[model samples]
Target chain A: MASNKEDVKLLGMVESPFVSRVDIALKLKGVEYKYEVENLQNKSEFLLKYNPVYKKVPVLVHNGKPISESLVILEYIDETWKQNPILPSDPYKRALARFWSKFIDDKIINAARKALYTHDEKEREKGVEEIEEALHLFENELKGKFFGGDEIGIVDITAVLIAYWLPIIQEAFGAKLFTSDKFPKLYNWSQDFNNHPIVKETLPPRETLMAYYKGHYERHVASNK
Target chain B: MASNKEDVKLLGMVESPFVSRVDIALKLKGVEYKYEVENLQNKSEFLLKYNPVYKKVPVLVHNGKPISESLVILEYIDETWKQNPILPSDPYKRALARFWSKFIDDKIINAARKALYTHDEKEREKGVEEIEEALHLFENELKGKFFGGDEIGIVDITAVLIAYWLPIIQEAFGAKLFTSDKFPKLYNWSQDFNNHPIVKETLPPRETLMAYYKGHYERHVASNK
Candidate 1:
């Protein structure tokens, strides 16, 4: 028998919230994995073969089976190694965390993107409605504390997506979607989340992310004038 | 001594996938609870208090702590009681299942609903593209006869939102988003899933669902015409 541990490989792009979520989860869990930076524009064959359906990154290859999607990978990482527990132990509490996480997963990016990126007045108006609606719900979910009831948990992971990605959108749209004064609870939540030690150390530098998204916005979105 | 059993109550709507996922998980795990049908139109004080943010259904009230969101609830159910294990033990495998489940949670309904409900040619076309794109990813993810690989797992529970809801959509749109000829794998997945005794029994009656949706769709979407 070989006395070697199998390597954990992560196929990810730096700019993606989906990919970054996985990275944060891995760090939170304290797992070491090899990283392959995937260019989404010109996807690698291995990526295509591994995740042919989505053609997206943040695929975790363990042993041989390839796992796609960030949250999926997060669960896998949390379970495989028992380090930092990302989810709460109580059933009802865990469920509450997952519910909002899923809500954030569904609403945070896709719903906001079209509106923020659109040149059309109608689409942009719809985007604004969606953004405002999302912020309203987000403010409500914050509950004047963390998403996991006065502690950081899965909803915290998801809330970070908006905190991290919204700046990019704020720049792209030339408007402020998340105002600290307007949604004070949510504002505090973002500040508290970013202040967490594990998160503080691992997060992608803000300036780097800003530079990356600036280029990404101008080139990819054809009608975003 | 007073009753030791917790005050376990589930706030749900009849035709809600979010509600149904938690119900099925609770039932499968042999957990007992009270069911309250929430009138989403007129928000209840309890719902507002329990799920203050979304004020949505499927808020599992256990010992008085309320949990919202279906996926989160499922994980909570799996962790708290530890019966049938809706999520697997291995982290990597569980994450993979969740990733696919989240993808479904995020994309599936929008894709199908847009195709079935929207009247605008461009909107409908965009919906079609989203549905087809989502399907390609699903097809890749669904390698096992079941989404859980052997038994129905959390991904299956999450995917059930599609399995149950699509049939209703299919009824409304006879053009059929998921015929045997089109989404063969999902078609089979849906059949196998719905046929399972636990699932088959758990679902709402088809005729009632169709009628309810007919009115819901017509009244809500003025653009549907």
Candidate 2:
């Protein structure tokens, strides 16, 4: 492993929520590193070398070694930094944290995309239901101020996209599923998550995300037509 | 945490490749525990209480605490029983092991199912192509006699189902994909993985698996008709 701490760098796209998860974790842990935005359409050779399997971004290079998958990278960060620990100390608690983090990434992200992108009524309804069911489970899981505890931890970091990007997607798709009354706990949690110091500073602006997504949706519709 | 090691109980089904993964881990770690096969069609309250989220089997219950998700449970077992480490000691290597493990579960499992079960010709072809691609990737990642280097670690455990069940499914479906010439590494790796002493002893017999899958496919086909 390379010894220089300054060698730590992140390769990602600007508007990617997955990249935003890594960005918030780094800022929260107070780790300083260089950020290089790769043109996802024309991926750089460095990015390809770092993550050949997925060919996706949000690859965290520490000590000249690459760690892909945002959840995996987050755990690595927590283990390496050992400051403002995102994962819990107990082994069982850590497992639970990892479970919920995977839950968000595996279930919510894809469901939300289907809900927004699928034009078919039946498929769109199924997507909406999946998102609602997952969020409901999360709402029940949250008993303290955050998913982890009184402070933000791994699960909250995994939920960056849900808190920040979901509203933009809802507006673009004209679907209002996350009403405050129906999911009061989750609604409140999203507000708290977005307001967190590091998260607020680092999360992409809503307008920027909205413009980017609107264009994406328009392009998708045009292509389909 | 449970003080008594004997309190470790695994709730699973006999034919489930996932359940076999936990069994292999327990046997390798030399952690003695009771294995209860659940009736998946009629899930027991114990299984439901332990894994309320996904409502699936292979729930590892230690003392009274329950950990779901086979990969999460594998990590937990590794942490709990340090005798035989299934994951790499270095954090970076551990991350790569997990990356491949997740790749296999998220990509290979679903693709293999689609390839075997889907009736649509185009979709089935796509699934076959996906399985071929993913297996090739696994083939390349293999080195030093095992994916985890000279020892059966997390990735090998994750590939348990693929090694044991894929051929059964292929035979039942009348499809041949993993030719020895086309995928020499993967083909050899499967043989090595299946022949591991603990795995060999614990893995469900091929005849049993074939009968179980034959019934499953018959039911699926009849329902679709």
Best DockQ among the predictions, by candidate number: 2
Q: What is the alpha-carbon lDDT of model 1 when measured against the actual structure?
A: 0.76
Task: Report the TM-score for the A-chain of model 2.
Answer: 0.94
Report the lDDT tens digits of candidate 2 across residue range B1-225. Answer: 224545889999889888888999999998889898899889999988999999998999988899998888988898888887899978888888989988988889888888878889899999999999988888899987888788899999999877888888788767887767889888888999999888899998889988988898888789778
Give the chain B TM-score achieved by candidate 1.
0.92
lDDT of each: 0.76, 0.86
Recovered native contacts, candidate 1:
1.00
Stretch of 10 with least lDDT, candidate 2 chain A: A1-10
Give the lowest summed-lDDT range of ten residues in model 1 chain B: B216-225
Name model 1 segments beyond 4 Å from true: A1-4, A110-115, A120-157, A162-165, A168-173, A179-201, A216-225, B1-4, B122-145, B183-189, B216-225
* Clash counts for all predictions: 7, 0
How well does candidate 1 reproduce the true complex, by DockQ? 0.60
**TM-score for all models, in order of appearance:** 0.82, 0.95
**After TM-score superposition, what is the CA distance of residue A26 in candidate 2 from its true location, in Å?**
1.1
Model 1's interface RMSD: 2.4
Candidate of highest TM-score:
2
Tens digits of per-residue lDDT for model 2, A1-225: 224545789998878988999999999888889998999889999899999988898999986899999988998888788879999888888889878888887788778878778888799899989889988988899989899788999899988777888777677656776778879988899999999888899987888888888888888678667
